[model samples]
Target: MKFICCGNKGSMPVNDNGIPMDTKKETEAGEPKYGLGVRHWQTFLYFFALTVAYAQRVNLSVAVVAMTDAAAANINFPEYDWPEKTKSLLLSSFFWGYVITQVPSGQLARKFGGKITLLTGLSICSVLNILTPLFADWGGWQLVCALRVVEGLCQGVVFPSIHTLISTWVPPNERPVLGTCAYTGNQFGTIVMLATSGLLASSSAGWPSIFYISGGVGCVWSVFFFIWGASSPAEYKRISPEERKMIELAQASESTSEHPKEKLHTPWLSFFTSPAFLALIIAHSANNWGFWTLLTEIPSYMKNVLGKDIKSNALLSALPYFAMFCMSFVFSAIATLLNKRNCISTVVSRKLFNSLGLWVPMCALIGLAYVDADQSNLAVILLTVTVGFNGACYLGFQINHIDLSPNFAGILMGITNCVGNIMSIIAPLLVGFIVTNEQDVEQWRIVFFIAAAIYLVGNGLFIIFGRASVQPWNDPPAKHRRNSTPQVESQH
Candidate 1:
């Protein structure tokens, strides 16, 4: 049986005897090698996962306006009292469960392989989405909220599992491009949901059809993913010996240590003790607060503040994410070029992109706050640019997981995302409180100010504390031993 190795550099292959040999030597010795062979297909698999997950997740956002109107139309008759507040709660309820599961979900991924964990999560989410339409008779608002929570809990593992797979499968050089591709799914999914849901919801089938459509798509995708995706390169049958050798060589050149058999005994005590980790956590939390606040509430904002019709609002809301999809690849390519050229340290490069990304959004938020609702088109343009700029930050924060510790990247991502998702819970509630029946400009202004401040602070922490150095714990004992050895005398 072949065992996998992890190290500061990346992943490596070891012989059955546990001796380290160059990947080239192994290939020469007729041992199998894995490279980028059929590896691009894995990217497609990940893309599919993201596409389906985001489509399902964003369906609620697309359905919210229609559902609210439906509830209001039936409110006068008798059985239900569906206030706007209840509608907002139903829309936001998913994040509550999503936030609670991030950490545990990551741990579970570590316990299981990414393939199993991801398939399970997607399966559960699909089932819940299908059941969502069924719950309409049980007071649609309450039923929707309950199902949203269940769906969120199941879906919470998606990001962490994706991170784990990337760390295990993708070469460090390829990570920037792959990361961008994975995130672009968010943009694409949002676009598809917004574009299609409006038409779907407008029919007599109403908002539930949006859920059914998205759920059906997700279930279909999940079946294909389970059939196709491998847990790691070792498990992939299509990878060629030459490709495998190249992958092992690239991974081995970076570090000597092998992958840990157990999960990086997350130094929880040390994590708390280290200011660097704390700062990373805090920065990500703040960053997510701004991100989620905008994502979850943008459709509602367009509808209520800009006075747009549902179809128009959906189109406008999707514009920013569409721009983001285009920009993410561009920005990631630039970052990777800089990395290849050694033009700047990894930390510096990541921070530079992150700073620019956050600053643009900060300025855009200020502009958004000041814009008159009458100038809805102008507001939409500025907001689109703001969210588009937000995509640049992924080069820093998203890829930093692998940069820091290839072995524990998944776990660290879990920790960061779990903490970050608290913002998701907070964002919708904050928006609900601020943009009530009065539609107070002052309240919305307060929300924007808070979001801007969070982004600024998060960026500051990243600049001050984030480092791209592979964590010391992930380094091999061999390298340290070799470095520590004293020079020997030449007796001759």
Candidate 2:
């Protein structure tokens, strides 16, 4: 293959000898350029879907502050005097339901297609979000926790379904850039919610407005996706024949024919025993511990320790995620460039990026542990840089499931995410125990230290054991002939 620099488009490698090259997967010679094709449009929808889903998921985290503290919102708004332990329970309740559906949702998406699975989950979550305020008023924090649990249950299919869709819709050559773009919606949603929820909570409409707005957007996005979304290239009736052919050719290794509808048989034993898969589980769980701790606790930390008002708390909390959102594109572009230029093996690239994402946050957390109320500005900057660099992991362990088994990417994500979210459920409750006094800097320091230590340990395991290359069990002999999988360039 010959690599030609395509400027901002990166290197476009052309087919040489009898081998097909990366560029050929999405763009055939004499075909329209792969820019803004229907597949790209579909990916954009996936990005929007995730953004909407996460907005709904996190609105409560910010709103819970205003709901509990009368001074956090308009004086006229209702406030509950829930204790810190109760608040922690409310925050962590969502993950209780979230962990339950991960494995099942992946199987459902595989059998019925990602389109139906994702839309069903989103639509239900939207209705539940819109009704959250009423439930909180009627039944208090207990009811609110129940409502969140149901919402989490409905939204559980989101990432798993998206993984399945990506494995089918995205070509191997474009997966790094496009897949990262789609998942960056997670950070974007957090940014939007954290930025706006504060102002909305203090507005005349009160904290309820936060829920209403996110729910409305989710509902609208669901309708849009229902009308336009396709589970795979084969399902997209509006896709051009050339574009469809290109995507199918690129995904040939994952499917038996143009669009194989068979439900994949997961190798449960192999997954449990594989060092690479176990490493992924640890990396994912560690990321969740740090991520959920920062995500769920930052606003409270700003409020109780730094003495920031709700509005300032929201805006400052959002800064880190905004940095994270922008950093995702930078990471993806650099990863794509490196892969295109043949500057690194897939294993090297994955490990290098994953380490950067984890170690920087570990150091930042260690430093953040020492910050006092007077050093709030320094604290915010450290948080921003920490989360910003965390975006590098999108190219790391986040997409490693597809690298291991495109055919079972959804299943892999479900299994790993299940384990990870269990940590999400634990992190908040653990914080409740460790930081009995939210205003106590020493207590908060322990929380940060634990998160940082987990980050260090998780990345260490991944660096030692992670493998980006396709495993032998990815395509079993009974289901697929050996060597039948068509590798899209050596990068696959």
Candidate 3:
């Protein structure tokens, strides 16, 4: 196979004998040009979908703050008298539904198609988001909690669908960068949602406007998503034959058929018993413990511990996510470079990136605990850098699912995400008990220490046990031997 000239993070012209070119100097140049690759378009649109998904998911946190404000009385909005416990319930309600749908969504994505599964999820969420304010006012916090749970049910299929589609479409060489493009939307979306929710709520349109805005954008994006989204390269209408052949080469599948073979069975027992999969669950759960702890409490900490005003707190709290989003692309490129150059195996690269993602944040948590109110600037920077490093997770366990089981990527994502969502739930409840007085800095230190410890243990187990090679059960038809998944390019 011959290679063509490439751009940053871009695919090179490919023939049967080779994969995409090295991305070392390429990523430095920027997004690689893929003129007729619908794969690139799909990745970009998936990023937008996830951004809208998170915006709908998190707009409530900021909106709820303004929801209880009498300052909005001049507008049509009414202040609600919600107890702390009720407010907590409202905030935590989404995960109740989120945790339940993972396995089912994974199965559905396989049985049906990712494009349909994702669109269905997003459609349900956007409608719920639009109706949230009206329901919250009419039925009160109870209704709001119920609605959030429903929204979670709708949104739960998102990542699994994305994973399934990626397994079908993304070339192995560009998977890290393209996958990061989609997944990093989590950080980028949260940052935008938190930053803008208040501004929308404070406007004459009031708290209701944030919901309206998020829901409206979601609805619009859904239309585009349904039209442009394809289950596989074979299904994509506009992709050039050159790009389609590249996709075929990337998968190295014996069949060049347009449609993926339908496989109805999920290897649930095999998955549960796998040490490698279990290791991922541990790592994913631990990452969520730290991430969710910071996500749920950062604004509160900014308000209570550091005594920052609302605007300052919002922007400062958002800084970490902003840093995280920007850092995602850089490390994704590095992971691709490392693997492309044969410097390390894919498994080693996952561990290395996962270590950087987990351990740096762990250390940052420890450092943050020592930074008092007098050192608030350092505290903010610590938090920013911590989350920035967290973005390396895209190159870690996040994409490891595809490596472990391209045929079952959706299932793995769902199962691992289930574990993480449960951890996300538990972390908040654990933190609630730890920080009896939110104003107490010492108590918060204990919380940070607990998160760091979780990271320490989880990363340790993963390094010891995680497997990046495809599992034996993934493709019954293929004759690949155990632990013999061929990589895109050999380092040697």
Candidate 4:
């Protein structure tokens, strides 16, 4: 309960009862120490948990590529008539469960601690992943689809909970880096899955072992996370006095209070009425449609259109995510740099990044539409850049969760993620319709064109309307701020 203030001006140590000690002359001491601490360790644990969730979630894409081949061997299907549709269904079924559970999972994160909700979700997902290959032949494709759906549902809470954790634990100045670091898990997970799955699948052991490996990793990470992570800074035992003061100061500046113990009444109407929130949802939804479609479909595309084998296909499919992982850090740093320099407003920085991110992919998709499958190397490069640009959108939307409402970041992220997940349903169905004949280059062009157009429209809306300021509903009036104690500390 004690507080300490440190700065270039000085240091003032305050007692637990809020009494200032007579160290007035010593107040002007030196610079504040800022680096990794117990809270940072907590953040690291949450980030690790998130990485594990993403690793398990995307492992299926790699597994499906191998699974189809294994299943084909068992059924004695011809190479040309392989069960591609069934494979696509398995990849897409996870999205169905993921999209449906976002809101409820977020609610759970808000109601219970994020630590408990996320840990429980990962536990369920790990068990289901282990059970997947076991049920593959016994219950057949239907059982596999059911298990995937279950995995998706459990994994759906991962992002929202992580968002909440970052909002709670990281200071404003550090959020961009933290957010980017947290999101890098998805790209890293994709890289690990794509890189390893094929090598494992190519062995005599076959495809099911890929699931087992990824499942085991998740289970192990879950144990570490449960041990190391606390729900919030207040619950942490080892947070330094200086770091705690920094968090308190930043929260006060942002005007966010500690989350109440009681369940928040749903402000559905208020959320629905916020045009800026709606714009963000639409923009992110469109981005997700384009991103997930490419992610889920790329392996099949590589094999069918480029005629690549499992090893090469896995390598090619992973290239985009690796590029994305690199780009996310660059783009997030650019936004933060812009904010610090006063080169642009936060709203403008977000809009600029969002527009560029969408437009780059649009051009790439268009180029992809015109390129022949014979130009396989060029096609892969374009696909890599196209998906890499997808990470840029995070600079806009991901940071906006904290920008708009640090207090309600968990709920806000849940809402955005829930709405955006609608695209998960749309993307697979759209691809199914457009790429009815996967071998036809022209047919696939239509899918790319549609994705490009959607991104364009969404970015345009964000440019025109998105605002980075906190929601009016959550902000106190100027008079209220004036009336409050000058030394009041915000708790978040």
Candidate 5:
């Protein structure tokens, strides 16, 4: 359940290096405003949406502990009696529909705006969540799978839509902080859902409450999001004219156009052929393999292998995400401070953080593989550290797309994520095939080893080829023919 936060240029401005410049001037109140006016609030709501999205995504994993006849908490609730293989399908089911919409969703966001794309997706997903329990009971596992696919398909628009929104609203200077903060909601949401899901399952009302509560919350968030969320700063109602002017000016300077929106275009051929883009694709896929493995299966591991009761299983399952949430702030601050001081190039910093995020987890997985079941505490510590270190990916390849192409970021993300999530489809299937016996430590060790190999290989490839600078293709087709010459494209 590792997640990404997007970053891009904003009004305060940035140099060609993607570092924030002090473009702040005096306001009417005799003070300097560094961040975007209403855009920051928009960022918050986006964060909230992402949080609800993940909560819906993972709640099933927690609820399923009490869902099947194989395991129970305190109450004799309704049982689906689905086997391990069936559970794997249920968990991975969301990815099928999720994979379908990536590219189309980006195009939709670009044409219709992120506000609608995001709202429509979340609204559908929330409705589906509310209805899931009834459908699962009546239609059985296949129905559950179909429902998950629909949810995934709808929610799949989320990441790319966020990319489109950030590119249009967030200034490059403010991206590291505001964008990262918005994305950290994923970690926070996972922490809360993982912790509370078991309690809800153990409640007198049973597992249905998990879906009911989470789905209800998501629906509520959608209402506020519809009213408050805007695709770009210019569309926002409460934004000050000065703030809007800065955003417009900053966008124009970077794109070399009075209307940067009109200048935006997607270079389909170039993106597919990009070595740098391929590196990110590999990194993203490998990351998902390891991450989805933990997110989808760890609760079962805690309950069956570690012999923990339902309450402890839920709390312990949540611990890694809690560490991850806290560490996101630490990782963001360090990235900000280093970028501010110019201590390292963005290229070097991105690689450093991305590698750190992957490599530490790789090592931890190896340790988790070797540790005995009796040493559950040590294994949990390693899991926490592994996921916590992964928070740095936000500063790394997650934001690297904006550095690659601010305008086409949504499209790039759509492609990379579509490909990467294919791993999500396969990871759960592979886990089901590999660990046929949920209680076997040796089977689990094989899973850990495979994740480690992926992390090692993926990070190595990225280290060899990843880029933090914009590609030449990211420039407008008729570059110098435009109103202004962009700093990156002028040299070309």
Candidate 6:
């Protein structure tokens, strides 16, 4: 995230590259002293959308426990006799569809603009969430798995579209603060859903209410975002001239084209060959493996090993994510302040934060693996600290895509996320294979050790090879440039 300083030329300001800036001074333009800009509003909307989207995704995780084991929840509202294997299949099934569309979703965001693409996907997923309970009851676990697949397909577009939007709306200088803030919605959403889902499952309305409430909120949010959201500063109708120009200049130092919306070819070969990108893929995949392992299985751990009822399980599970949410702000602010003051280079900062995030969790998981069954409080505290420190990752490989290539941040994210989510699909299935007895602490120890080892190996590779500087492929020579500008125009 590089900062751009511009010099004034008469009423207009010019960037170092000799590009004329069209933004006005707010004082001269009679704008208010302080107010939320269009970008800020866009960030808020994005944050909430992520919140609802994640709640919809993970609601099934908690609900499934109540659905399968009524005694664990201390409620009996039509429980099913699902085997552990079947439950695992149902849990991982979402990622089966999720990974398939990642690359294509990036292309969609590039073609149609992120606003429409994101809104359409979120709207469809919301509707699917609303229909989930009925489908589960009618078709059983198999049908529920199928429905989750479709929901996953729709949600596959989310992160890529968000990357597209952030690259366009937020400048490099603001990336750490605004980008991390936007993504913290992930932890916040998880905390909200996890904390409430157990109570919902145990209430009179039963597990069905979880889906109904989340889906309804998502639908309402979709309508509002559709009415107000803009794909980029150029597309925003309500932006003041000064703010718009500031964003444009901020991007001018990074984007190759005069108009970033111009259609450009994706450098697939470079992406695959680059050590930096490959390192990012490794880190992303490793994080997903550990993250999803805990995400899908911790509830069972609480019920089986710690003897917690469903309500207590949900609340305790949410504590780690709450820590994650709070620490995200802290981590991002620290990164921003350090970078602003030039305390470290971008690559070093990336590695340092990433190491802290992954390494601390690795240590915690090792300790978690050895916890006695009676020390449930210690287990909860370890898990909380593990997730809390993991928030530093949002400032690491997560934002490195934008640093590497602002032009193709969406595509880079898509590729890594696609590969990364494969781990999400695999982690649960492997857990099903390894931890056959959910109550056996020793079997769970194997799971923790494997996750920690992967964390160690993955971060080691990233520290050795990961890069944060812009890639040469982001702007090829004029002779090699392939612009389908007219294609985008004609289609739109």
RMSD each, Å: 8.5, 6.6, 7.2, 7.2, 6.7, 6.2
| lDDT-based ranking | 2, 6, 5, 3, 4, 1
TM-score against truth, every candidate:
0.85, 0.91, 0.87, 0.86, 0.90, 0.91
Tens digit of lDDT per residue, candidate 2, span 1-492? 111222216554332322113233334455434544666667888999999988998898899998988676987888998998999999999999999999999989988999999999999999999999899889999899999999889989998999999998988767888888899999989999999999999999999899999999999999989988888878866566666887887788555423344534467898889999999999999999999999999999999998889999999999999999999888877777787679998888889989989999999999999998789899999999889999999988999999988888898999999999999999999999999988999999999999999999999999999998778667643344456545522222
Number of clashes recorded per candidate: 8, 0, 3, 5, 5, 0
lDDT of 1 at 146: 83
Extract clashing residue pairs from model 5: 8-172, 9-171, 9-172, 10-171, 10-172
lDDT of 3 by residue, 417-467 (tens): 998999877777777677877789999999899999999999999999998
Question: Cα lDDT of all candidates, in order?
Answer: 0.73, 0.86, 0.80, 0.74, 0.83, 0.86
| Candidate 4 TM-score to native | 0.86
lDDT of 1 by residue, 381-440 (tens): 988888898888887777777777776677778888888888877777777777776355
Candidate 1, which segments miss by more than 4 Å at Cα? Answer: 1-36, 71-81, 253-259, 475-492
Q: Give lDDT for model 6.
A: 0.86
Clashing pairs in 4: 9-28, 10-27, 10-28, 10-29, 11-27
Per-residue CA lDDT of model 6 for 413-473, tens digit only, reads 8999999999999999999999899899999999999999999998999999999998988
Q: Looking at candidate 4, what is the lDDT of residue 348?
A: 81
Q: Model 3: C-alpha RMSD to truth? A: 7.2
- Clash list (residue pairs), candidate 2: none
Kindly indicate the candidate among 2 and 3 with the higher lDDT.
Answer: 2
Over 1-492, each residue of candidate 5 has an lDDT whose tens digit, in order, gives 012132335455543433344334555568455533466667788889989999999999988778884246645677877889999999999999999999998888888888999999999999999998899878988998999999999999999999889888877777777778888888888988999988888878788889998899999999998877888876865566666777766566556433355345567888879899999989888888888889888898898778787889999999998888888789888877787667888888889989888999999999999878888888889888888888888888788888788778887888888998998999889999999888889999999999999999988988999998878777655334456557755543
Q: Return the lDDT, model 1, position 195.
A: 74
Clashing pairs in 3: 8-26, 10-32, 342-491
